[model samples]
Target chain A: MPIVDLANPSRFLALTARLMPWLIGATVLAFAVGLVMVKGAPDDYQQGATVKIMFIHVPSAWLAMGIWALMAIATFGTLVWRHPLADVAAKAAAPIGAAFTALCLITGMLWGRPMWGTYWVWDARLTSVLVLFLMYLGVIALWRTVEDPSRAARAAAILTLVGALNLPIIKWSVDWWNTLHQPASVVRLAGPAIHPTILMPLLAMAVAFLLLMVTLHLAAMRNEILRRRVRTLMLMQAQAAPGSAS
Target chain B: MSALAALFVREVRLAVRVGGGGGIGALFFLIVVVLTPFAIGPDLALLARIGPAILWLGALLASLLTLDRLLTADLEDGSLDLILMSDTPLELAVAAKAFAHWITTGLPLVVITPLLGLLLNLDAGASAAVALTLFAGTPALTFIGAIGAALSVTLRRGGLLLAVLVLPLTVPVLIFGVAASNAAIVGPVPFGTPFTILCALTLASLVVGTFAAAAALRQGME
Candidate 1:
């Protein structure tokens, strides 16, 4: 089928319905394998048992940024091409993205208390991530405030694009201002600083988190399409009723 | 050209006259600055240490307070629709309004910062630095804020929502603004670096915010 067919709500719904179970199953399997790998990994020489938290924290942070990047791409779709399903994808991803960002912050704090000797610090990484979380909330609030779906989508799209442009600047300014959080260890040009014992679990958990995010996004988009359908049906019925003006 | 100039002048005049604009922002800046010394107690050193931050924050919040009125007034009075239908491009029109906003709201806050700096126990040089940064920096706030203003123009009681949407995006401006001031006051690092970055931020926001805000305004119109 042509990719354009996927823009049709019914076609998209049918696709998601068929894909949902497999996605859910894969997500569960990934999580189970990831957790087992995390458990089997030896404690860090420095961080000890608390290093285990890295499995969840790192993946959540990755997903937090990943989801926004996805939304940013969807934003271009909404604004440039006027893709019908693009806004649905963007809106569906927001709350889930916010949740992951919150999780990243909370778990970072939990990790910090034991490792950094404080519940929180105004470290560059921490501060930028907090800003990201706030940005997510703002996007969600913008989504809710606009009653018209198409208008809201375009408005939110513009905001998201502006935000995407700002994200690097935010990260750069924070990095320039101070340094408390350790610099990137994984995903560096020099290669992974972590041992394979730990790296395996982190990779597994990252995959698991990605799967979970995709599953939730698909479900949310399905619901949004259905909600639009219900609204259209209701409007049609109201217009058909006696004495009701179109 | 005359149309754009007229719109800019009209926006500035309305901002000064309207309850949501100039006077309130300056007053709120004063209150925030004045209340800080009492809240932190009379430790002169401490006050001086954080003074630049307090002033930058005051300027930030004050600019935010006046931002909701930027486009909403035009929107409510039906001027926005007329502006949309006009021959001039929407981007230039949005930029004009934001420039006018900086003039009426942001510039006053910059003017008052030196006086507020005295309340924070900052030295003359420190106060001068804060004022200079605010002068260079607050336009970024107003211009960037115009996007939020445009986004929230259709909503009732959108002032708070405007803040939420705009504040995080202003972090770079706030960071470099305060950093530039701090460098001037008490830094081993040279002041020129952050000051230059702050200018770049202002210029970048001028272009980015204008285009984004115009797009949002167009979307909202539909």
Candidate 2:
């Protein structure tokens, strides 16, 4: 069987176990390099040191959105392919995605206070990200409220796919609402107008965040699979016991 | 066809009877609208400026008040299972139920908006625009809400969960609804543009909500 086969949870666990250490190492190394690169980068003429906040803020924002996208793909797996691990992957990813989203919002707030002179603005981009964060909470709440794991997974998957419609709106809300948040600079048609010095640390930090997400997601999935095993064993034990009905 | 009509009638009748404190989405709307002045003080100008938004928000929340019963009531009585088994496609049945919900719950909010507008001190034109926008926009709320209603139907306490899940999805409707009304009241922008988008949102939700709710109903039954 392929090492990355979707059918077998134990095989998936074996593969993740082998990959976990290297992933952790890479994450640590990337964070180190990213911090150094950020420190070495020159201050922006307009924003000064406040621009350094972007190193953390931008990557966290990216991961926040990226994780939801990953969950949506996993949703498809759960709904269409019935991949056993897909729900596990999504459920595991929600809190981490939510944490990253919170980090993104906080960092953006910190950055905004000095730059935009407000801790919060009802600007389109900011408002949309806020909605995305709420949507994440809603998904997590859905998962918790439903007692049946399979039913919870199915419901969560449907909700995730439905919520995916908002991603593009979040991305373009700055343009649409013409709010205070700056328009997309990095992914534009002209290809990243940001200076190379700033862009480098940004890319490095993004890679670091991605690695961190994977490391956390794998750990969560392992715990989930093990948790299921524990539940099954407990059920069997209760059923086999003589006085279990009482 | 008759099965769906009967279902629609049954839902509307339940909503009308149970809609107030026992069943009153419009009463909730009145309270929410009525309290704004007390909360914001007696600045009639400010009230007028913000009235459309207040009305839209009230309508949005009022529609949500009754959505939990959309499928849960049916599911509780095993009527949902029969609806699922019937020849009528689940999507159509879900759409019919949502429509009935709109008629019983959402329509009352729209009808009462003009009266509530008077309390907010909105002029006739502003009040008319808000009512028009709500009329076009509240269907989307009911439809979009149907999906959340279906997803949360099995839970013991799903009202808060339904609101959390459904509210974010309704942001676009709220935006365009308010924007369209705002344009009519105070705008360099034309009312037609945002109003058109609001209608498009209603149509889109009508389709997406039906299919998604049906899918959720099917999943929940398992």
| Predicted model with the maximum lDDT | 1
The parts of candidate 1 lying over 4 Å away from their true place are B17-20
Distance (Å) between predicted and true CA of B132, model 2?
A: 0.4
TM-score of 1: 0.97
Where does candidate 2 chain B have its weakest 10-residue lDDT segment? B14-23
| Consecutive 10-residue window with the lowest summed lDDT within model 2 chain A | A169-178
RMSD of 1: 1.4
Q: Candidate 2: where are CA atoms >4 Å away?
A: A1-6, A170-175, A244-246, B17-23
Clashing pairs in 1: none
For model 1, state the Cα shift of residue A67 in Å: 0.4
Chain B vs. true chain B: TM-score per candidate: 0.96, 0.96
Candidate 2's displacement at residue B87, Å, is 1.4
